[model samples]
Target: MTLIDLTPAPAATARANALPVAIIGAGPIGLAAAARLTERDIPFVVLEKGESAGAAIREWGHTRLFSPWEHLVDDAAVRLLGASGWQAPAAGRAPSGRELVDEYVAPLSAHPAIAPHLRTGVEVLAVTREGMDRTRTAGRSRAPFALRLRLADGTIVDETASAVIDASGTWGQANPLGSGGLAPLGWDAVADRVAPALPDVLGADRERFAGRHTTVVGAGHSAANTLIALASLARDEPGTRVTWLIRNAAAARISTGGDELEGRGALGARLERLVADGRVEVLDRFEILRAEPAGDGVRLHGRRAGEAAAHDTDLVVAATGFRPDLGMLRELRLELDDIVEAPRRLAPLIDPNVHSCGTVSPHGYRELAHPEQGFFIVGMKSYGRAPTFLLKTGYEQVRSVVAWLAGDAASAGRVELTLPATGVCSTSAGGCC
Candidate 1:
């Protein structure tokens, strides 16, 4: 998380002072940016693709987050929520995704300072300079950004802004079932049988999974969460069976924290107990190559130990993790790392091959800056293909970026972050998968 040198050119500075800053997405990080901007008295607008703030989190509302309330809530949001007499959740409690949205994100969005600036059901189709594309560079830094957005009423509108902060998260872009990151053959044909990464097994989605032979793919916290839920479901419905698949030869990648482990530690402990009880069959070294419709379910084709292997199951939860959507930023000038697609200077700190322990140093506006000034991609989207991003890190990112935007150079340059060390080293650079 080294803060690279970022001296906004004179032309870019002039443009930044001209109009309101536009923020993309209204998730936690996006709202955090709005909070910071509100505190600074900066004019800003939040464009959310979903109908309301934290809509994405609502999709996986049943799954509990490993991080506690303290780590999840941003400082600026707390300040605003406190003024409105909002009661904070217990710091030690690890809340479910839904609780995070309902308690913190939703309240923060509705705060008087943020509500007027927020616009939900507005999707940013593209972001570029007002009068220029990627090819044009003359006086590029002086031009305001033109954001083409699709409104809730199915009408397209173009808005102009002095700066753009893309906090749009990676939840929408799920990894495919095929090996090598490409979609498997006939992936679309079996779309109906492919279960999402995070599903509420004991809740609303119970009917789709109970008493069914399910296969949980990927070896990450998400997969672990699903496996734990499915195990609970299996206890009541003895006919239900779960198969855990991974590319690694062993389950060592699972983060089983020490006795001192607290919040997320419970998840690790639960997973360890589930493995010990042999509740879920482990299929190690299974590289999924393809998926096809097999009767009412799916047949996954892959290889294990140089031998072709196939698994037919009623449901396939490909919790292979997610990737940032780069499609919307095509017209913007960005210097991304060849491997991770993260900001060039920031990739080394997050690349799985380099930092396996998930300890990213503190970084800020400088590290997130792009060739196109006044533009920053924070949150999980900043990590690109890497999955090492934490909510705390995203909060820190907005704090610095907003500080810089407000012309507080001192605060922007002095970025600080403290994160718990995961002693476990991941086989993949990001998280478990």
Candidate 2:
């Protein structure tokens, strides 16, 4: 890594210096930023749109993560949690989303140093420089950021911050089912037939998939996890038909066999065997074009290998991956890659079309920054449309960004991270859809 020492910035305007740094989202990465700022004795605020912290992860809490406990817990958060007599889960135990939040996120949010700065049930409508839009440039770096927010009670208010780190993940912005990356025709009318990316099959959502013809779409781990669950459901419930679809010629690259991510490798291996046993139907090179009503179910119109095709199913688990919500940041000037929508410098490292390594190179604030000074996109959202994010990557992101904000340039610029035994696989370059 090149040594780019970001020495302590002399100082900023009085207004900018007095304001606290604003960190968006209260998930693992956002909260980790808070802890890092606290360690630096810097004031900060965390805004969350959900009712509580880690709201996005809680939505898919039933699904187990491919990485284990050690990789999930952020170092700064551990420092805070450890002081309160918190016990760490076994290093090798891969936990479900629920366990991740309950064991690590919940306790970190409740920590006194961090809790006072966190505000849940609030939404950030837009972000821009005070008294200026993206077009204005004079003195932009000196001006504090103006955040337009809607309160839980629907009241609108404006907040200001010296710097902003958007750790708000991409889970809420699910990719559409269309082959062209847009929602298929008649999508809104037939939205009720689609299940979430990670439906609680064999649990809360079992009744929806049991004894029904359910089709799982996409070619990522999200699809694999749902397929495995639905396959299990078929065993106990007769007449439960399962079908898997992918845009590629073959169904593969769910996960790679490696020494590091055992849980993920196991998932890919099991899914392959399940498909071989003829328990789940495989549809490759299938492109969805539209949707229409089919009695009580829905018929998806598409093309299979340039020929028209159709499939009717009672339920559909899109599992089509996610994308960052760029609409709210329109007022802020951003330098994004045209294709992936990530920071231009970071896009090349994570672009699945260009990068095929087992893992990405270590990166920090320098790679995460945009043209808008003092603003950054961190965590999974930083990867833009790429689906190669891991919890440890986000941890490193906030750590460096917060250090730079605290005027510790050396720590911010000195990026050192490695995801052992892993590399990029057949991930979708088009937002993992």
Per-residue C-alpha lDDT of model 1 across residues 239-326, encoded as one tens digit per residue: 9998998888875445566522344456777877887899988888888888888989989898987799998998888788888889
- Candidate 1 weakest lDDT stretch, 10 residues: 424-433
List where candidate 1 sits over 4 angstroms from the true fold.
1-5, 8-16, 257-261, 354-358, 419-433
Q: What are the RMSD figures for all models against the true structure?
A: 3.2, 3.3
TM-score of each: 0.92, 0.94
- lDDT tens digits, residues 1-433, model 2? 3223234442458988899989999998899999999999988999999999988888888877756678778898899889989888899677788888898899999999999999999999999989999888688778899999999999999999988999898877888999999999998877899887888898998888889999999888788888989999999999999999898987555655642355667878888898899998898899999998888898999999999999898888888888899998999878788888888889998887654334567688888877787888998888888876666777888888888887788888887566666532211221221
The C-alpha lDDT values of all candidates are 0.81, 0.82
Task: Show model 2 residue runs off by greater than 4 Å.
Answer: 1-11, 256-260, 354-358, 421-433
Give Cα distance to truth, residue 171, candidate 1, Å: 0.3
